[model samples]
Target: MASAQDPATAQHPASQNSNGSSDPRKSLDGVVEKEEERKEEELISPDTSDAQPETRAVTGWKWILICAGLYCAIFLYGLDNTIAADIQSAILETYGDVGQLAWIGTGFPLGSVATILPVGKAYGIFNAKWVHLGSVLVFCVGSAVCGATPNMSALIVGRVIAGVGGAGLYLGMLNLIAINTLEKERPAYMGGTGVIWGAGTILGPVIGGAFADSSATWRWAFYINLVIFGVLLPALFYIPSFNPQPGVSPVIKLKELDWIGTALIAGVYTLFVVVLTLGGVEWAWSDGRTIALFVVCGVILLLFMAQQFFAILTTPERRIFPIHFLKSRTMIILYACTACGSTAMFTVIYYIPLLFQFSRGDNGIESAVRLLPFIIVLSFFIMASGQLLGLFGYYMVFYLVGGAFLLIGASLMFTVRAGTNIGAVYGYEVLIAIGAGLIAQIAYSVGPSKVPPQDMAAAIGYMNVAQIGGLLIALAISGAVFQNIAFHDLNRLLSPLGHSAQEIHGAIAGSQSSLFVNLPSDVRDTAIELIVKSISSIYALVIAAGALCFVTGALLKREKLYDSKPVAAA
Candidate 1:
């Protein structure tokens, strides 16, 4: 066998002198010399050490196909939301209990908020195409589980799982649009995408109510997603791979994940939701459980803020919260506007069906049909806002107009009473829907349009988190307001009719808003009046939320879109 020195000399033939023979010492010396050269090269060429992957440009029919797939996925997410709203009454009727009704709505948003940051980071590190597909698959599985669940608790758990998947799909879609579209053309593409989301939002109630009304049962509302996913999956396969940080190894990416920050945020929001859902409904607001949860939530939120602040100093690169963005007044205003606007929007979506079912004596299908004006108006405005944005290149004016409409609509809704004019009621709902649609998706573009492409994902993710968080808070607070007012009002009105306190509590807890329907005719009219009053009180909160949205929008600093690159010709 050749000696070690001989092998080194053979590998490095340059070490051989002009002579035909090689020296072992010379070979060893040359090996050291070449290693030193490699070290020098590495030091000088740091960028080549972990070269970034080239961004693959997707244009033409392939891009359109990918956008179409994303639209389907988002449509499924929107359908799930309205489906739950339409089916909650059915679920309450099936279980013959109203205590868990809030959980059904609360769980999905909680899960979504919990996963938003993590999912946003995941897209940056992995192949976005695969990540998006996996999210859709997970969502499909969760939908299946929800359909097959035998009890309310299982259904709530399934909603949470599906929500986790939705968080990923939502971020993935936005990221894809941001990456693929030109800066100047992004608003139009995003708005066009919003049209799909708007259609989903519009059709969700109609389709869900039809499914619930059918022999297929309310469970079919979820089962329908599976069929939709089958069509969407093939389209997803054609999406080009997009990995923003391909140079980063999976292990390094995992290490850099802000686990502590994520855990703190998740814990804080989870506890906050628990307190809101339980307080004044299942338990007294002063109950030990409620108090403890509120206190724990407060403490955890403080810790999360502290951790975010410390992260900026210690490990800014790995921080998920992106505290630097908060320094911009416009970003803060945008977030606040998004949150307040969402609060009003979600409150309307949840409670309007209750108004129809309880006050108007409408079934699920009938209520959805009655809601058509609202859905149609909302969908129209969503598409219209995008076109307006494309032409004007300004958003604050739309926000101001939208907020004014929301405030006017919400104030008008509170005036709805028994025997209120049907025409007037529909008109009010249309106004609110138009206002909501104008502002809802447009707020997402504000941050990304102003920030660099590198910051787009985080900025958009934060906006989503704000929206979902607002929905959760609004749902919790509005539920508490509705339950407490309805319970007390019903108890006062019914107790004089010889119903015991225990009986009043039992009736209200067992039948939900439908309790008014099951009462004797003599008491029914009075109960309906009381129920309408309680729901109207919740509308008062919506008014406040809308006004806050307006104020926040007015305060937002105006900024031109930082990126003005022309779209590539299709």
Candidate 2:
């Protein structure tokens, strides 16, 4: 009801003044608004074709030495992932227990998943350089234990311990790379990690097989980690101390860790992994023990979630998991794509060798050699994608194109039969390798780019969970699927041929089994076909993971990552 020119209905100061000249403050406000708009436009626009390289935090001889040390640690982490597979036969010969075989492969990933969040929090609260060195020391100790263990149980315990350290090493390496490089230059360095990681992953089984076949023995597979760590030890001391909480005392920083939350998360993940590992192998799906474990895991997970939100165990500022990340659309989509990509990569890495061993009758060395096409293509493309990202800033394109390739590749793999041409199989491997390489390490670069400088470490840690968690879950699921399907199909068809359950299980174990070696020609041929069918079924999981990558890719914003100035802590 007020008049248009009345004080109650006055116009905005920028609109007009009494003399019809613009107010000085309003002119300044106009300029500021326009500047902000320009920045926003730049953020959404594609990067220039000829962008110059930005200066890094550390350079020259120091960075090179640091990189050598970090890459060596990363290689060891990747090597440990699949090394146990080819060496399983040797372990069985020494220990005589086939039932515990799954633990050898699973223990490392389980340890990583259980402790990664707490390790992430520690990096946020303490000196990153010392934390990194401590992780290296822990990894070395675990390796020494594995090398010296006299029994299978002790070896598994060592693998789990090694996994704990390996998770920290992996996350810490990524964090160091993020903190040391500018946002614009991060992708290239991240790609270097990808190259090393791929080399180690592909070489794992080969190295293990070589050691197992030689007088050096399978124990040296683990002992090799310590040797690498010792060579790189001095370089680590020279690395910069990236202390986020620089003024905090060590005792106070220790108190800031969410100890109860760490225990709860560790308990939840370990129980869940145990259920997955033992579900059909050690116990029936209907077993009360499995159900109880599931229930316990769920309850602990609920408690952990509550702790993050309610701050019952620690302040929200000091909590391990960034619960608020759930609110970010970008983060959510990135997490999904990362998980899908990781699942696809690990599934292929673990199962492909088994397929070759069963279907082509290849030994460990031959199967590892056949994996070369996939690993090489994957490594090359990972490096390419990273370099391209730094130049183009169009990360969405990689995820979409990579996802499509994965789908096509996995579909091709699903059709492979026992007599399929090896050349065609290698071609299919190339397609999948390209897809995985393009997307696998992209998240580490992309994730930190999107977050503020203060949250960069947390973002890297979060993606680590997605990467390692997806691998752990996928391996567990595929192993269970392969074993159950192969066992059921083999028992139904071959039990009438006088094959015992133990013999069927050994066949499921693959060509390494003496029981499989003793089978008649006709029986072996039939067993191979059934095993091939089981392996083909596992590709269905890969296909699902690939589809997820595509769908999530479609959901990400088409904006380029912009550099954020470092924000000082209060």
TM-score of each: 0.83, 0.83
Each model's backbone clash number: 0, 0
Lowest summed-lDDT stretch of 10 residues in model 2?
Answer: 1-10
lDDT, candidate 2, 1-570, per-residue tens:
000000101112223334544332232235346557877987899478976765765689888889899889888988998887677767777776655666778788888888988887776566678888999988888889898999988998999899999987876776676566654566566656766766787788888877877899989999999888888889888777666555557998789888988898888767876787778777888999989888999999999999878889688777778777787777888888888878887777777777898888777677767778887787788768767877887788888998988999999998988888889989988888888877887777677666554465566677878888888878777777877888889899889988888767766776767767777888878888888888888888888878888888988778664442222222
Worst 10-residue lDDT window, candidate 1: 1-10
Off by over 4 Å in 1: 1-67, 177-189, 245-248, 312-314, 495-518, 558-570
Q: Whole-model lDDT for model 1 versus the true structure? A: 0.72
lDDT of 1 by residue, 1-570 (tens): 000000110122233345534342232345457667977997987677577754336767777677778888887776776577677777766765566667777887888888888887777556677888889988888888889988888888898889889877776676666555554566566655556655675677778778877889888998988988887678788876655445557886677678888889889888887787778877898899889888889999898899888883337756778677777767777787777767777777777777777678777888778788887787677667656766776677777888888899999999898678888889999888878877776666566555544455466677778888888888878877887888899888888777765555445432344445567887887777777778778888778877877887787556444333311211
After superposition, candidate 2 runs with Cα above 4 Å error: 1-67, 174-191, 240-247, 561-570
